[model samples]
Target: MQLCEKYVMQLLGMSFLQYSKTPMNDRWRDKDVTVFTMHDLVHDLARAILADPVNNKGSVVGNGCLYAFLTDCSKPLQLSATSSANIKALHFLDSGKLELRGDAFSLGTCLRVLDLSECLIRKLPESVGQLKLLRFIRAPRIRDQMIPNCITELSELNYLNLRGSHNLSALPESIGGMKGLMHLDLSGCHGIRELPK
Candidate 1:
């Protein structure tokens, strides 16, 4: 796995990219070295929590390397490699809020599930649509950068939980366009009144 920092519009200094050298569906057994602030350790821990396939008690659980952490704040790089080169889940638990320190559109091309819970995210970048395989999003406070109508383009999405956004007012009409979605949780979106109709 390789990680890089790159400049992205709207974000000044906190963006990263993840890349892989092989095809997905393979196994990523080699772990890459990453540096984290003591304060940022939780972010990596969060990824480990989500990426772990078995319970610590020794129960075989979910499988997949969907969780990841950001090493650079400028460009995206390979976070890890398994037999599977594609990202299936992501656990971004950085204490810092979600401010694009770099290009918001730099998410890796093969990412799937994304977990940004408990982070400080106010808006999603217009480039979010680039995750063609993204099936899950856990941010509940993304209120800015409208959920691009382009999100409807993601035919693979299944779960969407926006349960604590107090300021969000409405869902993108395009949301109805996500035909593959199986579940949607908007329990905390206080201002939202109706689904896209």
Candidate 2:
């Protein structure tokens, strides 16, 4: 029994080590690879984890492993695929000229936190309302941008930071409908003259 337990632990450790080395291997050997995206990395990680028999033993363990990998990774990337239903947070900092596809919002129905700080993206899709689970949004420097009125429909939103958005003139009148809002930062938004009633 002791030998069996030791073997099982070794197997688990090897599985984790194999996954942890994947991105590094790609970075070192695939210098010429240009088609790889964050979405591809995530998809590859999922496939690698699921292919392990230890993770596939139960849904609870599989999900736990996936979340652990995502949270513990030194650099987390933004969502870019329709298959990213389990992603909870997306951070797109300084990623140049991000042009979000129309169906992107619909794909991120499970997102809890979204940080697009300093990204070149000018506007958010009206389908932002579909992210009912979103709790935090930090989008700074999106000058002259007008957020969709549908944003007020995010009943779970708690923190919204729009600092340095100088040309953002106004908030939607329906802003009051976001009952869960606790913190709203509009610092550096010089165009706003009044708040909506």
Candidate 3:
């Protein structure tokens, strides 16, 4: 255990030694770790690290980390101007309780993938059309909401996932404008009755 701590400290320049508890029982003995909690922690940590301006300046696509997860809906997902400029992918997982701010989409001009699966977001800002580089989107299936026609403006979009979006009754006729699209997943989107010609 000491060896593991030492290795981690050497690698991460920090130590979890102080966080170690119940050394006699291997410290994890009484821990109540769950998959959800662990995922939340990982998401929080990724967001914190990516929020730093230092991580935003480089030309690294997606800041060399293509994924950012915001698991907690109680707090708004706020991205610094620079951080958003460099981010490539973002996920708002199962946040059915929170609404995403409109300005959030305007920041990630270079974003390629956006996952809003099961989120409570009611509308996407017109700025969503400004993300010309975006390639994938996972729109939520909230009944009262509809996907804006501006989504068709993503000419570079390759994948669209509307799985389980039960409330999505229609897609814009302009969807055919996405010439680059290759994969469309409408599984579980029972409300959709027809595809645009």
Candidate 4:
């Protein structure tokens, strides 16, 4: 392990001894680091890593990683990846309505910022509460979607946006549970007639 660590440090400018020690465990915990590839990542490993709430660095992957996933069209959200770990911030394409359906509660944990604008989504997972560090959530086009009552668990959240969710007629009675909320946007929620106090 020591030799491998020295070699890895020489090749990547960092020590990998911590990773090498955990032979059975695929996850290597650290903070403030940036991941830039998915060549060695496996799907199960990614799931295990994301399921942990103790770490806080983001995984960065290349194009090949993008092709490795299969979509699940049944659930409200599905996330498949060889590398989507320790992400603090995420930017989605095709209108940010992530095609997360095959796997329920795939958003994982420890996220600080989430943006899913104009994605035409209809709902979010109750598992979103897994993101204990989440402070911002922005998904404007998901209409009539039932917010998980668990969302009230995100005591760290400061911002929430439901703008343009024209069909979101109701919100969790727990809306009043977000004690850290500083700004909320429901600008285009035409169907909403009441907010939880």
Candidate 5:
């Protein structure tokens, strides 16, 4: 396990919350980190590594490691400018509303995990399919009626979640073609009347 010692401790803690499933091997990162309280850590986020809240409008915070949040996506937010290429995960905070530019999905080149379960965006950007290395996706409750067909191209993706997605009505026609898909969650998706044939 090449995961840093701190992240290793994090996995142990997440297991206590019934969040981290057992990984296949060292190469597989246990892909679940939910909000949980820990000693010295109030919840999932440990601390802010970088911040300039006073001048920053709405920042994407990452330190070539893990986790970033787009606090304000009232308009089309640009992630490419703030985030580094080495980030593994990105999550949107604030619980208001979000709108991301399609081109902004190019988060450097090495994003592996994404958590959009909180952001109530109008739609899932088509560019999301371009993140070919992504292994985990936790996007739920999107406002769009359909997910982009191109998302089926993510060959490394294993987990896709659309829990409580009230407006997401249809999945990609080629969903079954995702070679690495291991787990899919459709719980609470009220708009989907039938699964793709």
Candidate 6:
């Protein structure tokens, strides 16, 4: 079965877009690339539901502390330190390459999941390693960046996607020591000569 199908993530019957370039094909086979997306209305409703009044983070009940947010911020990106303490997720999939090398990691102490698709974050702060609860990270296309060795300290992290991050010459030496890491995607990373031993 397909990955989405296996995960039961087929949203609205059209929740995913596959990469298909073959011509003259009527039938759709299980392809390699699968990108998840939803209709604009679905996105709108999600934003509305996740909108927090005071913290400007995301929550199902608006006032509750399910704090997560979708951002499309520009340069000099930052978040409120006090408010980010309880935040759980932060998605920058829509935002362009953000240079989040500042207060974001230090403040977002409770971040469980973080998506930084194509972000310009060449390196992360040491504070990110301190977030013990971090479980997933989707940081594709951080080309030539040096992911901090501190990242391996996240013992709770289970999933990490770094596809298309070309020119990343090395991974943390202790990457294999991350016992909790169940998945690691390094597709299109052409710079690495070999996996860590």
lDDT, candidate 4, 51-86, per-residue tens: 654424444332212211123323333344434444
Give lDDT tens digits, candidate 2, residues 26-53.
5666574322233332344456545655
Which residue runs of candidate 1 sit more than 4 Å off their true CA positions? Answer: 1-67, 71-86, 96-105
Model 6 lDDT, full chain set: 0.62
Residue 73, candidate 4: Cα error in Å is 10
Q: Which ten residues in a row have the lowest lDDT in candidate 5?
A: 37-46
Query: How do all models score by TM-score?
Result: 0.56, 0.58, 0.59, 0.55, 0.62, 0.62
Error of 5 at 169 (Å): 2.3
Clashes of 2: 0
Provide C-alpha RMSD values for all models, in order: 15.2, 15.0, 11.4, 14.8, 11.5, 9.6
Candidate 5 Cα errors over 4 Å, as ranges: 1-66, 74-83
Q: Relative to the true structure, how large is the alpha-carbon lDDT of every model?
A: 0.55, 0.60, 0.62, 0.55, 0.62, 0.62
RMSD of 2: 15.0
Better of 4 and 5 by TM-score: 5
Weakest ten-residue segment in model 3 by summed lDDT: 11-20
- lDDT score for residue 77 of model 5: 33
**Error of model 1, residue 28, in angstroms:** 36
- lDDT per residue for candidate 6 within 92-172, as digits (tens), equals 544565565545555666676666663566655566777787876777776455687988999988778787778688899
In model 1, the Cα lDDT at residue 27 comes to: 48
Write one digit per residue (lDDT tens) for candidate 1, span 45-78. Answer: 3464466577677764644344455433223334
| Residue 6, model 4: Cα distance from true site in angstroms | 44
